[model samples]
Target: MDDIRNIYCVGRNYRLHAQELGNEVPKSPMIFSKPTHALVETTGQEIVLPGNRGEVHYEAEFVIHISKPYKPGMKVEDVVDQFALGIDFTLRDVQSELKKKGHPWLLAKGFPNSAIITKFRAFPGVEACKEVDFSLIRNGQEVQRGNIQDMLFDLETIILFCSQHFGIGAGDIIYTGTPAGVGPVTDGDRLQLKWGEEILGECFIRLG
Candidate 1:
């Protein structure tokens, strides 16, 4: 995980997720970013966050790892080397305020441990990915599940957009967006991330 460079994220890439958050569905990819220091691996250990924040919501996503420098015409399968399930932990209240003020989301999205990911596995190609379902399990109950086929902006579109506008390259990872069931996570919550039926990673939450 330490080798990761840029952390790019797409917001409201799922139509239902936009509606659930009272946000309009974007016509194009909604790009955002978190600093690299926000990353923490899901090693079944306790990860801590600010307890005083109003609410910390978990947005589970499909994380894509770029293997080589991106080129405009390259396919996702050609550039991507691995994939994993990850959580984009948000300070929801802070984000709401930022949105209202028309400000950047850095304060809400870039806190320590805000970006959590499971171990990466070899990329299985785009079609193979669309056939699998990834999910977030909280306290042993599934809270969010998603498949790549449902994304408003698919992998190719996202990669191209990021590469064209922001410049993607090796060591950058994209958090491809989450599904509709996002909600607040409290301290002591055990969160598990799964790809298909295999549990990729799990961790306990601790608020300080």
Candidate 2:
């Protein structure tokens, strides 16, 4: 088994998504983490759901994989090995209650199989990545569309910010947050993720 050293997620990195969720624009990046084992590769399996959670919302995000051990002075551009489209599944009902009580969102955000990923493509570095585009299609309709150019906090800043707290090392994965148009999924709903002309991955939702 391939072991993931760290799994870091940035919250509200997109202004539109933050506004859609009725959250104020953050002054800096809001960071959260998921256990490394939460990752589920989308190659050949469906995303299994938690039975007790009221609702599980799908958040389409761009994911980064760290290729080498990162030190304090390393540039974010150099640390990235590959890029892929990923989903950050959230238990919206649970998260709402946690927020109201001023509690951490552990169960709401970090449940097993909450992170789903596509096969990655080689990252050609930041300067060459300006025009990358990605979208999420649910049930044959486009739900979320995003361009790398629209990110409020660019890739370098997010990596640098996270490295400040925990050093980003090899096998670390960072989910760069979602764009607007997030919604709940039901059993039998199909999700397709695309990057430019490339089909990143696809999966079916199965809830019991």
**Top of the candidates by lDDT:** 1
Model 2 per-residue lDDT at 131:
75
True lDDT of residue 79, candidate 1: 96
Q: Flag clash pairs in model 1.
A: none
Candidate 2 lDDT: 0.86
Clashes of each: 0, 0
TM, every model? 0.99, 0.95
Summarize candidate 2's per-residue lDDT along 106-202 as a digit string, tens digits: 8898988899999888987776666777899998899998876788898888888888887788888899989999999998889999887677899
Model 2 misplaced stretches (Cα beyond 4 Å): none
Off by over 4 Å in 1: none
Candidate 1 local lDDT, 8-79, one digit each (tens): 999999999999999999999999999999999999999998889789999999999999888767889999
- The candidate 2 region of ten consecutive residues with least summed lDDT is 124-133
